[model samples]
Target: MIKKPLFPYNPKYPSVADLKRRAKWRIPKFAFDYLQGGCNEELNLERNESDFDNIYLKPHYLKTGGEIDMSVELFGRTYSAPFGISPIGLQGLMWPNAPEILAKAAAKHDIPYTLSTVSTSSIERIAEVSDGKAWFQLYHPTEDRLRDDILNRLKSVSCPVLVVLIDVPSFGLRYREIKSGLSMPPKMNIENIFQAMICPEWGIKTLQHGIPSFATLKPYMEKGLDLSQLGQFMNKTFTGKVNMEKVKAIRDLWPGPLVLKGVASEEDMEGAISLGVDGVIISNHGGRQIDAGESSLISLIKLANNPKYTGKVKIMMDGGIRSGVDLGRAHAVGSEFNFMGRPFMYGVGALGDEGADHTINMFKAQLYQVMQQLTLEKVSDFPTRLIR
Candidate 1:
């Protein structure tokens, strides 16, 4: 007999497919494509999941297996779950006031919610929503004063962790973005206007709320432009001087856990280790940076095997993590912290505030199924129970 499904919404609420569908409908086309699409060829995007699929789980039937603890501590604080919301910028453009909605949901669930420095919501705004259960992602500025002021504000709000996104030396080559002609302040063209008009729900909501822009940068920016304008400012503001000295300087001023994101090589990992870093996430900026770049998982294998860095510094990762099993595989490969960037954003974009909880619960369900099938009692056992 065919078995019945566990969830009511789409048989299992918040599945990756369901979440994707919802996000697509709620967000404008160009905005959705940027979040969902990868660079040219998307080789790494596919590899991110195929790498996990290539690894299987070895069941331990005799081991205890009940009441699995999903809680984890990372960067000096304990989180209710092993996963946290990854940073996404221009969230307001995707869905109005999206940062607050996601932040509130993350807070309610006791998970970490990170806000990008370029996000439309202010740090204080998300702090209010998430009760400061927030981390900040800095795309380092060229102006020292601008960087200092940004850091000072984060300190004032007491954001616990500061993430430095270094992979994006230049923005990833996003083709869909080029075709859509959908830039910020959304310059309406015949094609875009027609498309926007086609999606009445999204269009009406956007009209009522007004188009979302960089609210955080409003104080700093006087002149605005569409996608090209935003891109130029991004190029100007997010400078290329992200080096060890800069990180050391940031460390001196900020007392929170300092994470160096987009470390793809062991050399970079070692550099991060030597710099008084608290954590280094092996990533390719979720396949959004380079078209031909290697998958973060494959890169993770090389970095995690080096005994010099093992257990000395916390390792985190994110890319093509669409299920709980994927999370299991990432940890098994030596990552202690796992961040999912698109899933939670897609969730909130799909169903507003409820998206956060629904997506988390969806992962909980999938993770539980994987754990029980493997007959495992705890997450720490994953390294041994892993099958190649």
Candidate 2:
């Protein structure tokens, strides 16, 4: 007998691509561009998705399985799935209350939800929504005092893991944002206003939520700063590259699992292992950081195949993953864990409150179908099916 999907999702938008297509029309073009565009020429963005085509998994037709168990353990806790939501800054800008929507859905689904420091939701708010199981991704503040304060806040809420971003030494040059006036110190032009007017649903939601601001950082910011002033404040607050010293400092301060994100090379992987980090997320800031850099999957293959770093630390990856099939592909290539950013946002953008749940369920269903086809009983068994 065939098994039914564990979670119910909208059949109308069954895949991430469907959600993306619907989202393009539901939200303003500026918002859609921000959610979709990568840095510079977007070559890296194209490569991030296109590179997955190179990965192929072998299917076994004769073998039988007891059951496909999707649950995986990380940082002393078992999550419902091997994948989690990646941290996306300004989440509310794309869809009002996006972070909260994702957090609640993650809690209900029993998967990890990572909240960005610059996201439009407060740490406490996300913690409340996710039952304090959410992971916090810090952007590495320039001031030690601010860093300590943020750490203390995380401690108070019992945040499970702390992910420090190391890839963005400087913000990448995104041409779309520059052209749309979403560059640092954003502007509200006539075109932008007209775009918003045409998207009545988005405009209504924006009115209900008020203007999207950095909810987590509002305490540190002065009252009533305009767009340009807000940009200047952000630049001044987080104006340095995250170095070894900074990671070491964060490692010493936080007692829980500490992960360094934006790792693209073996050299950086070596550095992370030396610092005694709990894990390292192989990422290129989802192809938003350096346009000329290698695709994240290529970087993952290099680190995963290296003998020296094997089993030294937990190696995870995130980039170009749009479906359960892509998640399986990443696993086959040695990604111990996986995360996705834009797909979830697209779900919320296209479906509103139900979007996160639909996206999560869709991924779960797709992965289950793939595993059943391969007679694969576990997610870790994917590497054995890798066409290496």
Candidate topping TM-score: 2
Off by over 4 Å in 1: 1-14, 182-186, 223-231
> What global local distance difference test value does model 2 have?
0.93
lDDT of 1 by residue, 1-388 (tens): 9765442233445588788886787676777877787777677777876777776778888776687676787866777667888888778777777788888878887788889887878888888788888888998888889889989888888888899987876666667666776433245578766766666766776777677767667667756465767767766787585888888888888888899989998778888988888998788888877868788888887788789887878888878788988888877878787888898888877877667778877887787778788876666667887775
TM-score of each: 0.92, 0.98
Each prediction's total of clashing residue pairs, residues at least 3 apart in sequence or on different chains, is 0, 0
Off by over 4 Å in 2: 1-4
- Model 1, residue 301: distance off in Å is 1.7
lDDT of 2 by residue, 62-107 (tens): 9868778999999899989999999999899999999999999998
Backbone clash total, candidate 1: 0
Residue 336 displacement (Å), model 2: 0.6
